[model samples]
Target: MAEKIPAGGTDHPGRGDWPVIPDEREADLIGLDLLDHADGPDLVLFLAGNQFMAVPELLEAFRAAHPKVRRIFCETLPPRLELRQILSGGAWFRGRLVTVVPDCWATVSEAGVAALAEAGRTERGQCRAYLRNRVVCLVRAGNPKGVAEVADLARADVVVSQPSPVHEDIAEHILAMYRAAGGEALAARIMEEKREAGTTLLTTVHHRETPERLLAGTADAGPVWATEAAHAAALGLPLEAVEFGEGLDQRGRVRYFLCPVRGGAHPENGRAFMDFVRSPEGRAIYAKYGFLPV
Candidate 1:
């Protein structure tokens, strides 16, 4: 039997500390995807997954400015999956069907925005780029593997945590950076040869998981958005970045595009949120989390 240790290791009770909020629902699924007002949201947003860290700040400010919008449901999944969800009419979650259509959607890929326009779900001209980001090699603090640049990821000793091109939109961009650094051969070596060799770890969500991989010693390094590395550092995680710089980092190419869904439930709410996103306040919030401004 395991002995139970007192709270705080000394049974030191503090004011308003010991409590458990009772659950009234039969099944309360837990996840951060559903933010602010969970049920009956007036405005819904489907955002690119890597931008998950910025959602809270964006929401708080949005609420402060537009107090009437009490419920705002935002889902932060990979942009591709989010697009598919929007196109498919609905998606299943926890054995339940969630058919809530997003009023607004954002993606790092123009193709994703183009797809929606092609489907006639959103008007083509409304989609616009709002933010920019670039790739970097995320490494543990001190960079024990001594990875200096994007090309260094191909070194025999560096185990790279690469995002899967199939799931994450950022993966192909990172591969492009590899191509810039050491040409197509280097890109093939990292994604093909080393991937088959089990040294290139493919992550479903690079921004969220690469830090975990680096800290847990599962990966020596990873190619992730520079903002992701900065966001991880801000969280007090033992992580840092080996910057790919302007040429290799895909500076102009890595633009974040946004649009309001044409036939969404709340077009007014979506337009208001889009204003906030491109506003000075929105840019500041994203910059606070290390995103590059458009």
Candidate 2:
């Protein structure tokens, strides 16, 4: 196993080894964590992993619009970990302590913005919903596992790569979807009983693990953002997305927010990026990834 990254590592010794991203297959196990120019950027950001597909295009366009801000470092970690990294001051990634301060923080809920504001570390900026997404079941082609709907996820034969509620906000929404489909019993069966039976594989980074596990045939299906499944499918992965109706999928619950970090090194860059995200062109980038723009 690769060295585990410690959580809530706010106070580290100092800056040292920058993240050494593993190869593609190896990284599928750890979720691609780093994005953009990480080595000394004029602006840094902590973004939710689900919307990761839109970052490269968004950043590239933002840079083109404003060439002054050349370097931009963005970390697409889970929202909770991203919050902890900002609150704790740094992260002990692998064995190295990374201490880069963030200029912006984005998450699935406003609670992330509130948390930073409470810490007095949040900057005054456009803190509002910029994107939205809903749940879907990612399954193999031809529907071999027979997972046709959300309720099928609770079947005894199915093994699900469920995201950890403790680490990811999406888990609660997924749990709600399960409850809507099969009541509390279904939620318990998949989240508790199946997990005990070694059927529910908890994933810290479902964006990477869900498709990886499904394609590897280790898991029959997983609940993921529609955007995630679409992004993976676009990459030529042999997978199909099972759409959940509004009654089952938590349609209006998932909203994404971007909060500027107070006292960041580059204030203008953060503001510029946020402005661009709300622009029509920015919305197009997110829309390209199957995300609903706010």
Candidate 3:
């Protein structure tokens, strides 16, 4: 007898009883066509975000569950940019099945959630939350620099590298926290020094690339999600994390969400994948990656 396929299997076109949206616009927008076309051993799932490493165990489990799904197309862009691509419909080529992980603290605000809901209204499908992640700062191993606290970051000898505050929402939050902690004078002094000495003390890069630079010692410190930092440490990289003395704000800890592009071809599959992510097994994967379940 042939191997028994799972009940919700995607191996056969119609075996899983997957909801098939007839309208091509909805199907195409959600990436149903790509799923149909790439029905063999190489199904492509495009994921864009900053915390890729935080969920290795979860990914391994996902692979174990769905062996046919191969080739995860990923981009390490900042969440803000990812949001822009979704809003502008820039990912039409990658099939309508675009899955975006927005910065948990930055993009899941009341206004942000409202905006996403509006966007979904225009599209045929919808958006939903997948997981939550904690943002933390990564420092050199052993913190030999004595940069033990966020306030120490304002010291002259310290070089802080972060993503652009304007486009990188998490960076903006850190900046806000710094200002709240009375780092404004320090920021002004840094600006003055830059104007007088033409020295750039602060550096910001796209979110995905921040970790690589931190591991390479290109920067003394950078902001990163807790799980990403954990993964880096697991890799034996010379990195350590400094959680805020007061801890993350109550609301900040529960902000990450996964949004499915509207009018895409793979709403049903998208929903299924999301369901798997929310399942007990999926939660375990997320926890292993340092993300809290939603």
Model 2 residue pairs with clashes: 10-88
Candidate 3 global CA lDDT score: 0.51
Q: Which pairs, if any, clash in model 1?
A: none
For each candidate in turn, the TM-score is: 0.84, 0.85, 0.66
Worst 10 residues of 2 by lDDT: 22-31
lDDT for 53 (candidate 2): 74
For residues 30-59, write the lDDT of model 2, one tens digit per residue.
222333224456878777877667777888
Candidate 1 lands at a TM-score of 0.84
| Per-residue lDDT of candidate 1, residues 102-200 (tens digit) | 899988887777889999999879887889998888899998989887778898788988887865789869878888888999999999999899899
Candidate 3 at residue 144, lDDT?
A: 65
Whose lDDT is greatest here?
1
Question: In candidate 3, what are the lDDT values of residues 88-187, reduced to their tens digit?
Answer: 4343222122333221112433344566667662321334566666557788778766776666665666556665654455665565555655668755
**For residue 61, what is the lDDT in candidate 1?**
96
Task: Identify the runs in model 2 with alpha carbons over 4 angstroms from their true place.
Answer: 1-39, 123-126
Sort all candidates by lDDT, best to worst. 1, 2, 3
lDDT of each: 0.76, 0.76, 0.51
